[model samples]
Target: MRAHIRSTSMHPSGNHIDAEVDVRTLSVALLSGTGRMGVHLSAAWAHAGMDVRVCSRRKEKAQQIVDALLSGQGYSTGQIMVPPHPCDRPAPSASWRLQAGRVEEAADADVIVLASPFHVMWRTLEPLAPRMRGKGKIFIDLTNPWLNTSAPKGPRGQTLPPIPKAEPQASVLFHKTRFNDPTSSWCHAYRHVFWMLIHPTGPNPRCGERLGVELLGDPRAVAVCTAMIKAHGFKPVIRPGGCEVAPRYEISMLGRREKGPDAPPAAGSDPDGLIGPFSASPLIAVDALLEKAARHFR
Candidate 1:
């Protein structure tokens, strides 16, 4: 995508900066950079020409994810990727750069995407929230409480983290308890389905499809986030009734899935062997989501 720098806003510190720059030039910070959604988003935002910072509890882990994103290496099966030349270095971009950082630095970005698991969201946001105050940053919640079920163990047989107990109302609970703030713009988005986040190499793999992403939050915040979501290659569906009814929309979308509404898709369901089923569920119909979103707007 071409970098388009449009509009500007002065920093709260009394300096001129493009803090309110359009999506094409927006800077993004993805927390849990090594997590499933974070890794994909880091690559997608970087490919979209946005300055991206991938943060992790351990800076080294963040660095590893960032390196793979920039170098296009070590991606797991089922992800649509364009691997880099074996001996070639990543071509530097004049408009964007990807970095490995911590939550403190991430909070200062134009867009802060919370991709950590829902069970850990509050803990993750505790320290970072204070730093984002009065910054006009947009916080996009990508965390979903996985239906209050026990998570399956990893291949090594280690038990995974349990899903958040706040099942159907996870987003509502999140905003009410930990993330509500008047200083920064925040919303629950990209939580219902994220299969479109695939193919981070760019050229918008689902360009013509215009997959709809349901967003619930402050109007001003949703508008800004809408632009960014569209620029990154998805249609933004603004759900009415603000954050209070976030759970309604979340349930509406998930319930419309062709298969596995109560549980997530099976891992490795993507025949191409790129991203896992949770990230890119094969049965998720983009057209159906758009249809449902259209009904909401009516």
Candidate 2:
């Protein structure tokens, strides 16, 4: 919708002069820029005065998101500069701009946030693990992996089992693999429960901006990110050590499939929506997570 492609040069040989922009334009490159979380993050960054570069398999989709950002907040008019000319491509004679290209964007992004599913992380990040590390970058993992089941344990009817292992151990942890087992009778026994995963958006609709996230990272980064996530009308929980306590802490916070734990009891029998853990949203859970994380550091 809005095009803001500027022409500049890169000094690859160190002899030529390419204009250096001010730090006001904090460079960002979104991997899955077309998704909901990606779109939201892009807008959030722009509102904070950061320059964002979103990437998608479909260049058209990438441009479309750019347009949405402009209309939603009325700040940017930047263009989506890519290859395979779709009429917007720079002319063949156009000079190369020194703006950090795609690879550099990935490697040097100030904050590399992952709002994608867990599998996406396992597939894509596992490969880029080497370059994704270092200082000044935040790799946000907003995926909740969960599942519930009943097992034959000593007494107490039935008990939850252990999930696969993970490392670094956040103050609050998450494990994904242990949820594959079939549902046990204990869960089915209380079948008359109603679980509604409704957004605070409620009836007014516009009042629904209260969404949050769970942050697990360095202390300073955790504090900054906690504030960052909260600014979006959501809660922020700092997960200490992040993956360190992953296996032991993941229980109830997230499920392998969906619905966190189970519905509240007062409703009775007919469990509604995705029945699982967390009566509150991820934002709240992350807050709870941060508390757990802080203890780890202590």
Candidate 3:
């Protein structure tokens, strides 16, 4: 599955530019930098040649995470350029790939990776919506809308609760909030996929060359994110009908056995052991989800 990379070229006046946007040059901000997903993704993107900012409620926590990620890779403190202020942007001439900042400073980025827990997602982003709106920023929502009583950790290091039998379908999480804007687009990805499966240092994928990642959003935004996923070494399995039918994707992890009407068939084929007994592994759940969606929606 070689993804076709294209320029998501947007002009200042909301028109298309002929030149392609450099995936490496994209400024990415990871919200909740101390979280499991944030730690991995921030490092991954920074290593992939993107200017990444790991942002958190506490700037010190974000700085510590950034310093750790850099040190883990054998980079020294002398290589890092710590910003004097929380909102200060990295110097345009500086060559550092990763930095740390406050969550509100995420507005200065080209892409915002929502790595916060589902329970506090809206509360975290509602205020930042106005600052991020009309800025052509892409919002990558990796949060799952599980009705968890409390954040539960799965056996395989996944944050998942028991799949609820019933859930809402009226509006997808971001669409119901202030994030549904014309200038900026939101793409639902990394939801069902476990962090261990996609993280740089995690398990070696059972699937040979490509591991399918389910993506749902505007075509242009999806295309841009598809390139990003490909750069990170994962195949993008984009679902049709855009975000309108995102609710079906939201509960796809419940598997075929779920009694709820919203739960779509997990997958028509169980090639990766995704359709059998519940394992609570996102690798299986997400594989089953994208496989079923690829068949049904195609």
TM-score of each: 0.65, 0.45, 0.66
lDDT (10s digit) by residue, model 1, range 222-245: 666666666656656665666665
Q: Where does candidate 3 clash, by residue pair?
A: none
Ranking by lDDT: 3, 1, 2
Q: What does the lDDT come to for candidate 2? A: 0.35
lDDT, candidate 3, residue 36?
60
Number of the top lDDT candidate: 3
Write candidate 2's Cα lDDT for 1-298 as tens digits.
1112233332222222212323233455666555544554555544444556666556666666565344332112222211111234332212211121232245466545544444343444444545644343444454333323212244775543332334322212321112111210000010110112112111112223322233343333343344344433444433334333333333233322223354222111122222222333345445335545554574
> 87 in model 1: Cα distance from truth in Å?
14
The CA lDDT of each predicted structure is 0.58, 0.35, 0.59
- Name the runs in model 3 displaced over 4 angstroms: 1-21, 73-96, 147-177, 201-210, 256-298
Stretches of candidate 2 off by over 4 Å are 1-26, 72-104, 134-136, 147-212, 239-243, 246-298
- Residue 229, model 3: lDDT of 74
Model 1 ranges off by over 4 Å: 1-21, 77-95, 148-168, 195-197, 203-210, 252-298
**For candidate 1, what is the TM-score?**
0.65
Looking at candidate 1, what is the lDDT of residue 26? 69
